[model samples]
Each structure stands twice: as C-alpha cells, then as structure tokens.
Target: MKITTIETFVLGERQLLVRIGTDVGLAGWGDATLEHRPGTVAAAIREMSGHLIGTDPLPVTRHWQRLARGGFYRGGPVLGSAVAGLDIALWDLRGRFYGAPIHELLGGPCRDRVRLYTHALSARPEHTGEPDRARALVAAGYTLVKAAISGPVGFLDSPRQTARFVRDLEALREAVGDEADFGIDLHGRVSPHHARRLADAVAHTGPAFLEEPLRPEHSRLIGQLTATTSIPIATGERLYSREEFLPVLQAGIAIAQPDLAHAGGITEVFRIATLAESFDVQVAPHCPLGPVALAACVQVDLAVPNFYAQEHVIDLRSADSRDLRLLTGPEVLVPVAGHLDRPTGPGLGIEIDEDAVRAAHRDDLLVPRGTPRWSHPDGGFAEW
Candidate 1:
C-alpha cells in the first residue's frame, strides 16, 4: 500500500514520535527523538516526508537509501535520526504486512532473548546512596548496571575529583559483587589524560566497560587511551554511522554502542553490527529515549550475533513502568530478569495509544523548551 500521510508528535519533554499512515488504513510508528533537538528533528521529518507520501511503504531498504543518501550532504545526527524515524516505521509497516516481527524478516532470531542493562546512579559524581541504588538494581534482577562519572569534569581536575570518581565506581562494584557487571559512563566530558587516569584507577573494579571516555571529535585519541588501560572502551551514541564508527573499531574498542535512533535505525545499525563483527567488537545499542526506539533496538539485538546488551532508562516490568505508558501490547518489551524474550507480534511488536500520544503532544505545545546551556566553575562553556 502507498503511504498516505506522515505525521510527527512531540511528546513529553524530549520525545519526537513519527507516524506513517498508509492507504490500507494501517499506521506505523517510530521515534525520531534527538534529545534536546526535538524541534529540529521534527522539522527534518516534515521536510523528509515529501519523499515518502504516496510511495510504496513496503520497500524499506530502497526508501532507506533514498532518504539517507538522497541528500547531497549525506549524514549527521539530524538526517540520520530523521531517516531513522521513517525507516523504522517502514519496517514496522513491512512487518505488519507480512505478519512477522522485524527480526524474523532480518533473518530470524540469533538468540532467544535480548539482555539489558540500566543506569544506577545520577550523572553527577556523588557516593551518597550509590551502593544502595546498585543493590536495588541488582535486586531487581538486572545483572548489568551503569552510571556516569560526573557532570562537566574540568580539563584537569584535582586529585579529589579522581578519587571520588573511583570511589563511586568502587561502591557500585562492591554492591553488585562479582556476579554482576558495573559499567562506567564517561559521557564524553573527560579529557584523554584524565580519562586514562580514571580508567587506570577504576580498572581494579573490573568495570563492564568505560563508555565515551572522550568526545566524538577525539575518536583518534581513543586508541591511545585504550592502550593505556585494560578496561574495554565503548562509544558511539554520537558517532551516527558505520563510516564514522570504522576508525574507532580499528582502534580496538572492545564494544560499539550505536543508538538505533541516531545510527540510521534498523537498516544502518544492522550494517554497523556486521562491520563491528568483522573487527570482533560487540554491539550494545545506546537507548535512553522512548519505548519505540527501545523496541527497535530489541529487534536488531535479537538478530545480530555479536549483540552484547541493551541500555534503557526504565525497566517496564518493574514498579517504575513509565515505559509501558501510552502503548498497547508493551508486554513484548517487559523484561524477564533483565532479558526481553523474542516478540512474536508483527511490526515493531507494540502499538501506540494515539489518544494518549495526542494528549502528551498537546501538553508539550503548552510548554516548549530550548537547548540547555551549562558552564564550568571558571565560567567557560561546558558540555551538557
């Protein structure tokens, strides 16, 4: 069937959802969330929708290439994420037409379940309640947990800062014991010199990995930092494409964390995983967004052989189940002991609550937000 209309709904604080309506009275949904740039991504979707209306929605790959490479200025967060929203929805449409999950179309399931991990502590580096939070996460049946090092670390902070960073990680490790894995997220706020020091200091804790030690621009230096520490280096929530991820993989990063939303959705992320597989690197998709993106990630995670783990903001099966909000058949995403079983439903395997989505969209219209700004102690601009 032909695509009849394309729509985008900005829900909550930072979610941008896209809905593709077809002539057959079926609608497919996907998340185009770009975090702080919801307006920008929504505009990009509006612009890209011109290429999709009245086109065959089942030719997902053909549409992916045209939308992704159709522009002269190839790839970036905006375009990749925009294409990701449409591409995922196209896959959803194709799956529904065929009565199979996206993974089944991708070549069937590689594993029976997809493992997941969640963040324990706040991004701010503080030891207070750190261990208790770790214990709670482990008690919830999550075998893997992650936390950021600190917020906006100075170029060269004092020894006390390093000590506190180490202490927070140590506390998490101790709380989880040897059975579970603790990951440290550098959040691209730490410099190479300090990243090395932090990695070395926390190496004894046997972290699951050190994520985004340096910003995307400093990818060349990642190998240098990896050489200095034994902790596995994982990055790529910001990289966006396989071309961008090539050098980082060659640099010997043990894990590659490509966000399905930012890395061109299922089509490109599958390619990224295959590329990483050639280099013997694992794929742990970076997903802190909404349920649609999380569902998209699980579809890829199940079909890829090198899949490591999935990152999410909330556990849908737990007491805090905001993930289940505004959706029907969210059971496809509910975690059983930190693992998601293969979804047997067609399409993205979950349906959207259009009324709830519209309500959230109306609320968002009442209060729009601009990009956030932050500053270091010296008053210099800081990364947020």
Candidate 2:
C-alpha cells in the first residue's frame, strides 16, 4: 500500500507521537519526543513528512537514506530525532504487515532477554550516599546501576571537592562489593585535568564504565583519558549520527551509548550498532525517555549481537504507569530479576494509550525554563 498522510501529535507534556497513515488502513506509530525540544523536533518531523507522503513503507532502508542524506545538511538532534520516530513507525508497519516481530526481520534473536541498568539521581549526596542505594538496587534486582558522582566541578576547585567525590565512590564499591557492576557519570562537568585526576582516584573502584567525563566537543580527549585509566569510557548521548561516533569508536573507546530517540531511531541505530561492532565496540542504547522509546531500544537490543546493556529511567515507569500499561504483549520489556525479556509481539510490541497520552499533554508538564543552575565552588557552570 502507498503512504497517504502523516500526522504529528504532542501528547503527555513531552511525548511526541507520529502517525503514518497508509492506503491499506495500516497505520504506524512512533515516538519522536525530545526532553525539552519536542516542539522543534515535531516540526522537523512534519517537514520530513513531505518526503514520505506517497512512498512505500516497505523499503525502509531507501526511505532512511532519503531522509538522512536527501538533505544537503543532515544529521543533527532535530533531524535525527525526527527521522528516528518515522523510522520506528515504518519498521512497526513492516513487522505488522509481515505478521512478525522486528527482531525476526533483523535475523532473529541473539539472546532470549536483554539486561538493563537503572539510573540513580541523588538530591543530597549524604542522604542518598552510594553505599546505601547500591545495596537497595542490588536487592531490588539490578546487577547494574549508574550513579552521578560529581555534581559539577569547577575549573579550579579545591582538593577537598576531589576527595569528596572519591570518598562517595569508595562507599559505593564497599556497598556493592565486587559482584555488582556500577558506572560513574561525570556528566561532562570536569575539565581535562580534573577528569584525569578523578579517573586516577577512582581507578580501583572498577566502574563498569566512566561516562561523559569531558564535554562532547572535547571528544578527542577521550583517547587521552582512556589511555590514562583502565576504566571503559562511555559517551555519545549528545552525539547524533554515525559520523559523530567514528572518532569516538576509533579512539578505542569501549562503549558507544547512542540515545534511540535522539540518534536516528531504530533504522539509524541498527547501522550505528553494526558500525560499532565492526570496531569491536558495544552498544548500551541511551534511553531516559518514555515507554515507547524504551520499547524501541529493547527491539534493537534483541536483534543486535553487540548490544552491551540497556539504560532505563525507572522513575518514569513509576510516575506514568497509565502510559506504560499500554505495553500488554507477551514479549514486553518487563524487569525480571534485573533483566528484560525480548518482545515477541508484532511490530515494536508495545501499544499506545492514546487517551492517556493526550490527557497528560499540557504546557506546564514540559521541562521548565531556568530550572536550576549547578555551579562549581569557583563559580564555573557545571554540567547538569
């Protein structure tokens, strides 16, 4: 059937949905929501829809190329995110048309289940110290957990700040012991010098990986940091395309964490995973968004052989159960003993609660402006 129309919907405050209607009454749904840039991304989706209006949805690769390189200037957050939503919807449509899951089309399952890691954000470092929460996560069935250690480092901070960061990580290691794997996210707050120092201090902690120790633009520094520390360096949430990932991977970085929604959706991410695999790099699939995005990531996880693990924002699952309840398939990404089973249902395997999504759509629910500024002791703006 030929494509008929494309519609974009902004639901649940930050949820951006794309519906691609075909002549055969089969419609595809995708999530293109960016944390704070939903409006801009939605507009990009609408603009890209002009290219997809009358095309066949089956040639997914051709469509992806058209949307990606069709433009003279391609591959950024808005364009990549917009294409990501459409690519997922197209894949979902293809799966439904063939009466098989996306994983089957991608050469079947590599594993029965996909393991996941949870995000831990602490307001008060002392109140929610690493040791106390590490035990709780392990007990709650998580083999992997990521914690933000340094809030924001200044250009010229005291040795005391560095000591505190090291102490917290030590406490975490003590709580989890050697059995559990943990990751530390510097959040790109530390400079090259500080990053090197901090990496040295926490070298013995055996972090599964150290993430975004430096800013995205300073990616060349990753090679330096990787050389200095044995810990695996992980980054790329801010990065958009395969081109952006080339240097990072070539630098001998261990993990490539591409956000499913922000990267080029399932279509582009599948290519990204393949590229990383060629370089002997593993994928974690960065996803702190909603259920649809998580479902999309899990589908990729099942099909990709080089997938390392999945990152999830467990808080959203608790806060928006109604939206999450839409996932009622046998292969739903349910956390069982700290791991998620591969989805078996047709398409992306998760259904959308249109009513619930629309109900939660409000201007106030979006991330607020000027939320808070985190700074270092020397008045330098720190990464948040």
Candidate 3:
C-alpha cells in the first residue's frame, strides 16, 4: 500500500504527533517531539513528506535512506527527528500490514521483557528530596533507577557542589539500598576534570553507570574519563549517525544511550545498537518523550541482544501518566516490576487518539520545554 497522506498534530505542550495514512485503510502514528524544537521538527517532517507521500510503506529501510540521506543538506537534530518520526510511523503501518510486531519484522524477541530505569529528581538539592520515591518505584516492580546528579554545576564545580551530588546519589542509594540499581546522569554538565572527580566520589555507591560523563563532542576526553574511572561510561544521546559514534565506541565505553527520537529512530538506532554490540557494549535507548517514541524504543530493546535498560521520564509515574495513557490509545504498555513485557503488534503498538490529538492541537496544549538555563555566581553562562 502507498502512503496517501501525512499529518502532524501538536497536542498543546504535550506531544508532536505524526500520522501516516495509507490508501489501503492502514494508518500509523509516531511522536516527533524534540525538546524545545517541536515546530522545527514538524516543519522538517512536512518537507520530508514530499517524498513519503505516494510511496510504498512496506520498505521501512529504503524510506529511512531517502528521508535521511536523500536530502542534499541533511543530518542534524531537526532532520534526524523528522526522519525518525516517519520511520516509526512507516514501521507501524508495515507491521499492521503484516499483522506482526515491528521487532518481529526486524528480527524476533531476544528477551521476554525489557527492563527500565525511571527518572529520580530530588526535591531538595543535597538530598534526593523524596528518597522514598525510589522505594515506591522499586515496590511497583522496578529494579533499576536513574537520576541526574543534583546541585548546580558549571564548567568547573566547587568542592561543596561535588559533595552535594554525592550526597544526593547517596540518599537514593541509602533509601533503596540493594533493592534497586542506581545510575548517575552527569548530563554533560561537568568539565572532564570534575566528571573524573565525581566518578571517584560515587565509585563507592555502585552506580550502574555514569551517563554522558562529558558532552558528545568530548569523545577523546570521555576515553580519558573512562580510563580514570571503573564506572561504566555512557554517552551518545546527542550524536546522530554511526560516524559520530565510532570514536566513542572505540573509547570502550560500556553503554550507548542513543535517543529514539534524536538518534534517527528505530532504523538507525538498530544499526547503532548493532555497532555497539560488536564492541561488547550494551544499548540503553534514551527516551524521555511520549508513548510513540517509547514504544519505538521498546521494539528495538527487544530485538537487540545487548540492550541493558530503558530510560523513562518519571512523569510516566505522575498525574500526567493519565494523559500519556490517553495519547497512546490501547497500545499503552506500562512497565511491570520495572520491566516492560515485550510489546506484541502489527507495527510499534501505538494507536493514536486522533480526537485527543486534534483536541490537543485545537487547545494548543503543546507543552513548551521549560528546561532551565543555569548561570555561575559571577554571571557566566552555566549548562542547563
């Protein structure tokens, strides 16, 4: 069947939904939500659709090639995210057409369930505010949790700031004890020197991994950081293509954190994961977006043999969880005991609530990303 139409829906400040309609009564949905750049990604998707409309939806791989490399000027967050949205929607449509799940189309299931790690932001700076939140999630059947290291961090951080990050992680570890595995997200905020020092400070805590220890551009520095610390160094939520990831993979980092939305969707990330696998590294797709994006990541998680854990926004555990549930229609696969059972489907198992999607657009509920931009005491710009 050929793609007859491509549509985009902006649900207030929530999700940027992309829907692909086929001539044969099959429709697939995906979220193209790029933090702080939804409109731009949407426009990119519209531009890409010039090629997508009237094309066979079955060749997910070929479509990815055309959308990603077909453009003379290509490959950045905007185009990557745009191509990612269509790739997922096309996979969804292809799966429905085949009456199988997207993972089955890629390969078969490698594991019965995909394990997950949720966000653990602390209420207080020095402590993991409600340290019990980790316990509650563990009680709900999660075995792993991850949170950003708390306290303000600049190009260089002070002794007290470093200590506070340790304290915050310590609080979570102490609160959950051995009941769950904890991870530290450096979030590319610290200098390489500080990252190495922080790694030493928390080496005693047994964090499962230190995420984005340095920014994506610091591949060589990351190698140095990896050498200095025993903790597993994870990065690459920003690197878009296989070429960008080669150096870091060679650096011998343990985990690759490619975002489903930002890193070229299921098609490219599957390739990225396969590359990581050859290096004996594990894949933990970065997904803090909505259901369609998470669903796409889940499919890859099941198909890849080296998938370690899935990262989810803690909001999935919040009052907004209902809204997420609504957006997903009946394709919602909530994590059980911190593990999501392999999603079986015709395509990535997301069915768009077209009405809700349109209502959100009409209501203009597109959630603006309000991520903070930090600053030093003397007014030097700080990392967000």
Best by lDDT: 1
Error of 3 at 236 (Å): 1.5
List, residue by residue over 1-384, the lDDT tens digit for candidate 1. Answer: 899999988885557898999999888889888887777888888989989999989888999988999888979999989999998989998999999999999999999998889878763434422678788878878899888766668888788877887777778888999999888888888889988888888899899899999999999999998788899999999999989999999999999999888789899999999999999999999999989999999999989999999999855764247767878766777788888888888988888888888777843442466556778988998876
Q: Give residue 200's error in model 1 in angstroms.
A: 1.2
Task: Report every candidate's CA lDDT.
Answer: 0.86, 0.80, 0.80
Better of 1 and 3 by TM-score: 1
Local accuracy of candidate 3 as per-residue lDDT tens digits, 269-384: 99999999999999999987777788898999999999999987735553246646545444256666777777776788666667776666733333365578777788887775
TM-score of each prediction: 0.96, 0.92, 0.94
Q: Which of the two, 1 or 2, has more lDDT? A: 1
Can you rank all candidates by TM-score, best first? 1, 3, 2
Tell me how many residue pairs clash in candidate 1: 0
Candidate 2 lDDT, tens digit per residue, 1-384?
999988776664456777788999987778887766777887798789888998899989899899888999988888988988999889988988898888889899999988888865566753224567778777877888888765656765578887787777887778777888888887777787888888888788788998887889899778888888899999888888888999999888899999888888888888889999999999998887777888889889999999898998744224335546544442355577778867777888776665655565565534435235886666766677
